[model samples]
Target: MVARKSAFSSEYSWFKGNLHSHSTRSDGKLDPPQVVELYRSNGWDFIAFTEHEFYSYWQELSSDDFLVLPGIEMGLDIPKFGRCHHLLGIHKSGNGAKHLVKAPPAEKDGMAGAQEEIYRLGKEGYLTIYCHPLWSRVEWEDISELRGFTAIEIYNHSSEMENHSGLHLDHWDSFLRRGIKVWGVATDDSHHWMEDYCGGWIMVNAPQLTVADLTEALVAGRFYSSTGPTITDFGLDGDEVYIECSPAKAIHIVTYEPWGRSFYAEPGKSISSAVHRVRGNEIFVRAEVVDSNGKTAWTNPIFLDKKA
Candidate 1:
């Protein structure tokens, strides 16, 4: 029998949510209440208001069907590089969540200062996510040494629409190639709801829609990032890994060593499922699905070396 390692489980339900967003509390166009209503009315199960260096529970916005997660976005400028580091601090609960409202004090330390802030946030019960790298002008060397990130934004809709700085698959691959196990996230990072809302999100497989359950599912990598497509199932059985998703133009099985396979649908056609037989030596495997319209979904890598 082949070792089994899957990012999702059969026992959980899928809930859609965005982990990063803004409102009038920060530099966003809408107010907190409007942002909450916009997402809740559009079928989102939860959302985090990551105001710049501001923390709020937004308890009134939450309902039995919707959740408001405590969160903040913190940044530090690199001394001379014209670059910066922005991190999302999403708390499981309000406890200790306000600790990150204050910016990091050591600005002169550059990336070191940012890493320190990330570490500190983790200690305070916040799941830290490295924000848009391309938009921030972040190179691999700038953040290669930082640790404790639950995920990195592989696709930022706002960044992509404003410029083309979103979709940092290379940055994500760099970390995975280095044996780092951080997950990939797709977010709207929406400030202006006009064209920025709902372009990207994560479908989390959690036992419930509560903050605690969502946070636990995130920490366990029970989710897939997407711009449009939906991944219904993903897992490895024996030497083969399989994916079941919405109609797609192609499916690529990516591994750490470029030893994986890609399957493409014929012209004007689409595929809804595919499978790849993994080489026994692969250290990890992940899937990327591209729809005919160019929308994509990403599955978290299954670390073969760390199989349970």
Candidate 2:
């Protein structure tokens, strides 16, 4: 059987969205309505209002064309490092209607606290996304054993702009290399609403653009993350793993360490597709496309040992 977890399909439409953001409900520069207007007017299909420790369902801001997902970000302290763990909890259409009633009390037990909060969020019917490991100063060792996160932020636009610690592919590969089946995401943890609002986003393939459809797609890894590049298709058929993207400077088929391959375009030119013949022994496979400007798009890994 072919093992592939591809989000692309002719039947589904792609929607651009940012899963993490803030507003004046927390410390964001814009109010909730302004944040909604900012993304809506900018061509985004959806935005999640993940204000810190404050949960609100901005259903009033949503229209037939734009969606506002109910979301909140919980912070747990790592007293040892004086930093905090940021977990984004996003609810489906009807979920998380109540305010901050079910959120767990802030804990300071380092890794254990983070794990507990993740478990709590899942139990509360929210999909948890571990946010910005590099900005949190979390090492692979700190989160290798943590479980129940639907995805981790491989790139956070705000973290990259403010702290220069946005990309966390090393942490993502650590989870995948160990056979952990978590997905990766790129988000603009946008608080400032200026340059941070549109730096990173995801393209989700879903049947429709409702909160339920988008939430389900995100939970099933039916999406890919991007800073600028676009991944048109990615999947595996038998031993042939393939990916098609926009004109790119380089395309990489990422697999188990020491086993993957990279294809680069010739000087003054660009390539748009690449294929890798799987050895039938690699743990998993994913794709990355890099544009001439060094912007990248990433696909979620497909575990070869599992059937499609």
Candidate 3:
């Protein structure tokens, strides 16, 4: 495990960026600079250079308008099991740990290996996340039962395409059913920054645009996942709540009200209007939209009146 590295903070700003990527550092072709430049040139406010199973987070930026967080994928090296390779989201750039996979101890080994490594990072204050639990059809029944990372990605654009992994809705739904309050993220899983890439993203509503701001927003779950549709405003009032989307083909108000009443507003779930209505004892409410290509937009969950 690595120690806390030095890095710049986003200062409570909305730094739109990606959480997963591959470069020549691992199996991907692009270099760090080329990867950074591609996203920066394309209006991406931030990016995490998750090269491989090694922790190589970069800090120093070319200017204030852009910032890059150094990171790496973690887990095991068992490519055959498809249970290897999990993502660790590092906020601090250059805190070099260099230890990719901590070898299993012939003696004191069990779940201690993963628990120690993960907990050690958490103890040090890094914002870690579990990326694409199903990248290899890996199950989340265990990870969902544990508490280590702060967030999870319901959709990893790139992996979903190459691996043909399901949309991850099943896993996300599982977490919800268990009362797990972990935040949900939708990432481009971008490696190409150019071309037909760059649709999976999170729209975070914050007062500023910086890494610190974005990180805080993320930890607080103040964001929405989207493939294309961007939700502007969504919330509830008393027995009546509302949602506003950006030119939606259809708006579905998915409400997990009362923290356990799993209900969604879509073609077969609730009502359709490109807008929604909530007048009941629901604890949470949100909006979603789908295009003809089956792309979806997930709005941040909103709190509704518990007594409603």
Model 3, runs deviating above 4 Å: 1-14, 77-81, 92-115, 192-196, 257-283, 303-308
How close to the true structure is residue 194 of candidate 3, measured as C-alpha lDDT? 39
Would you list the rank order by TM-score, best first? 1, 2, 3
List model 1 lDDT by residue over 9-55, tens digit each.
78888899999999988889999889988998899999999988777
User: What overall lDDT goes with each candidate model?
Assistant: 0.87, 0.86, 0.58
Candidate achieving higher TM-score, 2 or 3: 2
lDDT of 3 by residue, 1-308 (tens): 23321112233334567766766667666777787787788777777766554655555543577766656655643334445436465553234533333322222122333445566666555677767767745565345445666677778887776665626766665565455656678776666633424667776655565556666777767777887765555554334445555554456656664332223344544332343445555555656676545678876555444332
Q: Per the 3 Å backbone cut-off, how many clashing residue pairs does candidate 2 have? A: 0
